[model samples]
Target: MQKRQSAKLQREKGRARRRRRRIRNVGAISRSEVEASTVADPLCLNNGIYLLVRSYNYINILYSTISLLFSVFLFNRPSLSLFILKGKNYFCIVLAAAMSPWRIMMGMIKEKSIRIEKARHVFEAKEEYFIQNGAMLLEKQITCNQGRDTEPIKIFSAKEIQQATNNYDPNLILGSDIATVYKGMLDEREVAIKVKGPTIYCSTELMVDFFLQQVTIKQLISHKNVVRLYGCCLETKIPMLVLEFIRNGTLSDHLHGQRNKIPCQISWLDRVRIATETSYALCHHPTEMFLRHNNLVDYFVLKMRENCILQIVDDVVLSQGSNEDIQAFAELALRCLNNKGDERPSMREVTIELRRILQLVRSRDSKLSNEIGLALT
Candidate 1:
């Protein structure tokens, strides 16, 4: 009876163990299924929705592109001419709406500001040029020399000069070489405008200095034979000189003619007179400034020294002048052209010598005229 009871007890224990094992297996399967469902459900839904949204966006972009292109194509076609015309009023309305009074005023203000800025820069540049060209020096000279009887140096504006020169018309050009001379009218008087030629060889500083020095020297000189300096224009890069205009051509033009041929024959007496007047003008100023040599003068001096001056003498002069007077004149000219500055005679001495030569020529002419008259009678 004890053995049977033990066997039954063992079988009951085995059944209990098997039932616990089955329960554990079922719980594990249920937990795994629940976790998988929870993870996969939202992932699948999200993937599907993402694909739908992406497809919608692509379709929308494609539609917009096609619509824009189609609209442009349609608008460019001839069939749309009437539609465009009909839309003009709407376009005008839209334009008018966009261009409000405030916007218009702002644009105008911007344009005006630009113009003002440009004008200011131009004014500043002109002022700088004025100062650089020795305006202060000129003013001081004028102030120091001021008197009721004295003629002051006038400062000319660029505009006034332009108008006087007819805007530098080509027809108004009197001559052009190193500098251009223009015929103009200023202050109701006929004037000659002298402007430096545009050249790349010179620098601005050198030109400015030259102009200042020229103005200073010329203003101090007052002689009938010398070209009168009326004023100067400093508005340009190089200053412009306003001079008294002579109706007849320049002395050079009169002596040598325009192209090459002698324009007119000036009698020997007139030539001597002109020379005397010129010498007087030179002597009126300091002689030191007039001692500079030029190629023409050097050639003349060489010929004079060689005693071959007759060859270069003008035909009119040779025909009309006395040999004695010519010799004396030549000697005087040689004295004036001496190589040593200190050895050169003073301008006063030159003037006196010229006057003596003139008297000799005049007395000889008078004696000749008397002889001719007596012989004719």
Candidate 2:
């Protein structure tokens, strides 16, 4: 019985010690888990999330800032506007991604609306100018003079002429005087565009009336020597005329103006032919008008009066022209340049005389060529 009680006491002591150790181990484990959770659970997770959110915000801000700067810079420069418009597709994608899609869309819509409004205003202004420039009256007269069967003068749009002339670049200018002439391609055909320049001390109404009359007369006056009037643009304050493209320069430019290294010189035969053709064109003009006086006419009168007209002839004409033919031409020119309109030779008589001179020159040339051929033989 003593041995049994001793053994039982020992066992009880062992059980108490094991239980204390288990309790201590469990408390240590619980404390360690609490400390680990405090360090790693909410704090680490929150800090990592905060860093990620901050980086994302920075990226968004950087993107938006870059987009805004590009937009402002591109919009400010007029020269770069074309580039921006061309690359707008790429820019739109970047802008939409960097900024709010809704805001970007709204801004684009507003810009589009503004452009449309501006275009509408421009169109209305062009229409008003077209009406104010006597386009209606011109159209009525064209219809009346040129029957429905004949094609009337084409009325070109302002945009068409502008595009044709590359906005009237100075480099493409052919001539400038009462009107500026531009060389351009219209409807796949070479055309000369004549835009009247602003004149000083000119009444607007008188100018408009004069321009209207000139256009009407040109439509009625169709001769081989006269440049064909193709069309006109009335969409501007001053109407623009479209004439046939003459590759060669004008007679005045060839005769008196400084030549631009042209290879061909006008021969005496060509001179007489030109005079005949000019008289043919003048025959179409009103016959009852007074003779137009200019410096050339005055010089001719002075030279003829002095009997020194041959001295004033071009070197080419002096070399090839016959004295008799020159005398006849001088007499005809004097008659045409008479100060009194009624005393001057009518255009019909002038044309006939010029033709006779041209025929005589051709006959003389043919005889000379025949004689030269005989000598060669």
What's the TM-score of each model vs. the native? 0.61, 0.61
Best by lDDT: 2
lDDT of 1 by residue, 244-272 (tens): 99887776777777556766556777778
Instruction: For model 1, name the residue pairs that clash.
Output: none
Backbone clashes for every candidate come to: 0, 0
Q: What TM-score, to 2 decimals, does candidate 2 have?
A: 0.61
lDDT of 2 by residue, 136-181 (tens): 5557577657653433588899999999999999999988776689
Q: Cα lDDT for residue 274, model 2? A: 86
> How much is 13 displaced in model 1, in angstroms?
79
Q: Quote the positional error of residue 174 for candidate 1 in Å.
A: 1.6
lDDT of 2 at 282: 74
